[model samples]
Target: MSIIQQMNSKLANMIAAGEVVDRPASVVKELVENSIDAKATNIMIEVIDMGMGSIIVTDNGMGMDFLDAHLAFDRHATSKIMDESDLGHIMTLGFRGEALAAIASVSKVTLKTRQENTEGIEVIYHGGIFVKDGTSTLNQGTVVEISDLFYNTPARFKYIKSDLAERQAIIDIFDRLALAHPNIRLTLVMDNKTIKSTYGTNDFYSLIDQIYGSKMTNGMTIFEQTVQKIHITGYLLSPQIARSRKKDISVFVNGRYIKNYKLVQAVIDGYHSFMMVGKYPIALIHLEIDPSLLDVNVHPQKYEVKFVNESILAYYIETYVKEALLKQTHQIPETLKNISKGLDETYIPLNLNFGEAVISESKPVYETQNTEKTPKLPDLEFVGIFSGTYILFQNEEGLYLMDQHAAAERIRYEHYFNSLAHPNPAVKHLLFPHHLQLTSDDISVISNHPKKMNAVGFYFNEQNDLVGLPIWLNDSEVEIAIEAMVSMIVEKDAIDLAILRDKLAKDISCKGAIKANKALSLSEINSIVKNLRACENPYTCPHGRPTLIKLSHHDIERMFKRVV
Candidate 1:
């Protein structure tokens, strides 16, 4: 007998099930994705015992005819694709044709479907065997019911997670699918009770509120950016609502949920100065790209995708995210908004002395609903410093308190960032060869990508010794800058000059900013205020700390007995 024997169709399907329907959530994902591809505007998913006991999916979508209804359980049977060219342009979610077969092989399945101009039909399958077929008096749609998951293959049940874990996993899939297609109404029912529901509507803001909470939309903002053919729409929540895990940082490409580290990191990078340490913002980034530019067949579950020119796409996403955050900076440090809202801004409190009026010559960028490009800062009269820290000022709209150190950091960060971006390299000879001792791993990393340092205007000899300095870097900060660069490269093997430049800028600016409890001359105050006002984003420093806050004139009156 030949050692290599072809497995039976049922055995083959059971093998394939290991990849497609490994968990309750995977089965739910496939069934729901099919409904989405079928042009379903309404989908309902009901699961019992965390989907191990039974799983039911009903959709008001284009139903399969008698032929497709039967073949749907056969391996490699699909309506999504036909030939090789179809692979390049895969707009549908379930193209592989493996899900139904794989799922049916492991469990009992009942499918009832009725296509247009066709009579209703029902079919049943047990462990990949066609048990029966019959007529049905059903509506014009499809309903698939799966029961006794992993019943035939009892060994697979050992890998099943706890009921709570499986339930949460299914819920995560529901959330992803709901977000991907907000126009579709999706409901999840577990153990005879409704868990989540999204009413079919185009109002994504409302949909998000339904999924997250009623007040979620309050902290979230929408932003749009387009470059060439690629368009991205980002819904970024304020950092205050950020979660500990990167799970909430979801990304969708061509309306399909995908896992792209570069794209997700781009959004995080855009939130660089706006996010506190050890926290990731809750963000939903959707990318609309030409199907030809995307390779969706890379993963079995179709979560990981490859995009041509992904770096360019990431760059645009990062830039626009930063732009949107800068435009909405006043909303951060949240206490400022909580105090001002529903309060009378028209009232000017009594018994308060605001010092001499200081008019800023340059405009400052403040939060506004206006479409104009230039951001405007409030007009304030300079008041004396408080507690040797806050730079106080008063305007008709409110009382302004500026964190002097934070303001300086923002100003200097922008300065260094701009210089790094446009390096006007005035190379000078070093008094001594600036030598950097590197570990073997560091040397290997440097040798692997020798251009990363040189691109930033740091030249090294064969021994990895720095020989020249860029004019933008001061002599005093040379050791600090070089040490930081080597550490970054050694730790993560960072190769991008842009990222390196940003890291250097953040570090250098923090080191150079003025310390607190120090008095300033009148001219120094004017200069600091002027430079800060001119910055692209002056509301927060590189570390996401607020540089200034505003308290309206009415806030003062409410504090005293002047007004209630």
Candidate 2:
């Protein structure tokens, strides 16, 4: 007998399952994509025992006819594409046609489907083999129920993750699919309880709010930008509510969620100066590009894609995100931060609290949208300084408490940031020569970018000593400013002024700002408040920390139970 022989269809499909159906989430993703490709406006996915026990997907989409109802279970059988020419321009989500076959190879499947004004049919398959076919009395659409997954291939169970892990994985996938198509009403149920729901509402932000939970969209802003052939819409949350993980940054391409690190990083880079180190913002980027420039067939599961010019696309995304964020003014939200961050890591209990997100067969809550923006700071009267940290201020609307250190940082940061970007600057003559102490590495890093240093108004002498300082720099902070500039140059490992400016601004602002537990005279306190109000983004420091918080008179009364 020949050592190498053709494998049977059952074995082939089972082997293909290794790639297409790695976990319960994989099954959910494939089934949901199929439903979406079927033009299903409403889809429901139900799972039991973390999907190891059973999985059912029902959709009110265009169902297959009697012939396709049976053939859909065959490997490589597809109605999505007719010939090889269609491979280059795949618009449907299930073009490969291996999902049903691979899913059936290791489990028992029952499929009921019907077309408009046609008789319904039900088909059964076990281990990729057809067992029986019968007439069905179901409505227009298709229903797929999978039981005993990986039953034939018992060893596959060993590769499965834990129950909680699998549940999160399934929910993550469901979230992505629902996020990609907001016009479709999608629901996910686990153990008879609804996990998520969206009701064919085209309001992207409301859908995002529904999926992510109430108050999650508190600091988010939406904007759209278009290139020659590509248009990107961004929904970016403020850096004040930054998260520690990359999972919250979602990117979609033509209604398909894809994984592209370069693009995700671009979104982060746009927030270079706004966010603290090690923190990331939650955002959704939708890239609508010509299909001819996109290659989605790169990854086996189609999670990643190849763009014609990935770098250019990333640049646009970063620029647009930065512009959108810069256009908005923010104030410290007194109740939003503590409540939002206090929730569980994963979204939950939203169906009860969010009347706008989760709903029944009624009118959309966001049908008439009410817009809200972070209000501008009002002119405040200096009450007093408390603990040498918080400066108290009051206006007719509310009471304001400002962090003296953070407020100072924001004021100085804008000054240095603008000075660095200026083409021409005035250098301040030092009354006495200030000697600079720098390691050889620091000198070398600064030496490589002499022009950049001069452009920012920091020049060094032949002995590696400072000659003069920028007019914007206070004489008291001469040594500290040079040290800050050098550290940024070394940390960034390059002389790029655009990147160096932000780092230097952060370092200089924080290092020179007044410290806590220090005394400030009434005049000094008023000066700080006046300067802070002049800043472009006075609400936050350079490192994205809130500089001020508001407490309404009603809030104080409620806290004391006097308002009730």
Model 2 segments beyond 4 Å from truth? 331-564
Per-candidate TM vs. native?
0.61, 0.61
lDDT of 1 by residue, 349-438 (tens): 111011111123343222232335545466778988775557799878878998776777777777667667754456656767775433
Q: What lDDT is obtained when candidate 1 is compared to the true structure?
A: 0.75
Candidate 2 lDDT by residue in tens digits, 36-119: 999999999999998998999999999998899989998888889888778677777778889999999989999999889998
lDDT of each: 0.75, 0.74
Model 1 misplaced regions, further than 4 Å: 334-564
TM-score of 1: 0.61
The 10-residue segment with the lowest total lDDT in model 2: 346-355
